[model samples]
Target: MKNSRSKPFVIGISGGSGSGKSTIINEIVERLGPEKIAVLHHDAYYRHRPELSFEERTIINFDHPDSLETKLLMKHLVQLISGEKVEVPIYDFPQHLRNSKTKKISPCQILIVDGILVLNDSQLCELMD
Candidate 1:
């Protein structure tokens, strides 16, 4: 049941907070089968700012694209497309910082990237199929 394609098909989903993007993604994953797809959340890529206190981090505008480490995400996307595994960052929502642990994701036939500002980045948009 593995994907036979040489490269995974990348899909980017973007929307504002409280939107139905997550719901839509869930439906798609359910219909397509989760085993055949890999999902990357932009929220998980939030920059790890250890120097900033929890209060300071909370004050930072997370809605801005600058708050995310898009470069790292881009690099990981490239690697996933190349059939390589990646250790994705785990963000602590309450603390507004990245946890020391990471989630290891394997390349799949379909790659779904979702975030509020995912499509806002020109370079990141270029990577989508």
Candidate 2:
């Protein structure tokens, strides 16, 4: 007996590099049915550097949190809670910046965000509260 009224129970799945985060995400979607789930990749939130030259964007190590546009990510998460569609930025790891185009995400019964560094931010942890 699960609570069916909760709108999109957000589950943050994280692990070290090469971990099974993607596998777990797929499993959740499979068990719950695609209609009940939506997956968001943290990689889509990497910081943008429209000011930086191509060379500068390429040399940075993107594994750290600084490389991510977390503030924007946090904002969109809040918007989705209100059942609004959001435009999630697309990031290029090798380039170390967000792509020119964005991805559109709609609200679902369950939103599962999967990535290596997911839920590492204190602000994000508080948002769940």
Candidate 3:
């Protein structure tokens, strides 16, 4: 479904590592107030590879777009746009796996998706406003 005018204005921020995506998002959040916007980090959606050891996971190139679970992120975005609550996955960067805990994200007036490869996914890009 398409996002309606009453729904949140979704913004996808895509850039390389240390490219100041967070800086930009943070600035917007500061001006808009934390309660006015919802932030989703793409790194938090990394695929859970529990079968691999920490060493093996460390060797994996997270820089690759495929390293993230883009599909799940897209699903969550859909739910958010539909005015539904979503349980966003929490990732353990040091362990290279998704943690059991999840963050409950509610619908907001503005949604900011911050990540390195957000624009690379056609479906996700199409869904963004």
Candidate 4:
């Protein structure tokens, strides 16, 4: 994991879409302050299905785990676990995909992951174990 190389503490949060994970994250951020913590959105992990265009991906059942880019997310997860800096892709919900530029993240004391189906993948489940 790019962010975990330093053995940083990890926190994973999951829920249905629009489940207010952000609100909770914001509250935690407020309590912890920007300096003490870091957060990651699972949407950033989505694999780029170049074969599937934005329209096709959007038409699919996004609420289901199959719609996610599990591979890419796993890569980032590995990086975080390994304690390395990562440039997380910014996924566009409206476009139903990630853009080119990515947001840079460096592991801090605590790393929080929030998303809808992040834990649904068997790979991630194993990682969680």
For all candidates in order, the CA lDDT equals 0.93, 0.76, 0.90, 0.72
lDDT of candidate model 4 versus the reference: 0.72
**Between prediction 3 and prediction 4, which has the larger lDDT?**
3
Among the numbered candidates, top lDDT falls to: 1
Candidate 3 local lDDT, residue 93:
84
Pick by TM-score: which candidate is best?
Answer: 1
Better of 1 and 2 by lDDT: 1
Q: Write the per-residue lDDT of candidate 4 for residues 87-111, one digit (tens) a residue.
A: 8888777776678888988867677
lDDT of 1 by residue, 1-129 (tens): 566778999999999988999999999899999888899999999999999977899899999878999999999999999889999999999888899999999998999999999999999999998
What's model 4's TM-score? Answer: 0.79
Write down the TM-score of every candidate. Answer: 0.95, 0.86, 0.94, 0.79
Please report how far candidate 4 places residue 66 from its true position, in Å.
2.1
Candidate 2 worst ten-residue window by lDDT: 1-10
Candidate 3 lDDT by residue in tens digits, 4-107: 57888999998998999999999998988888789889999988999998889999988887798899998999999999999999998877888999999999
Compared with the true structure, what per-residue lDDT tens digits does model 2 show for residues 1-129? Answer: 264765557778889877888888887777878877767787888777879998887887778888777788778777776788899888776666767898888887777776777789878665552
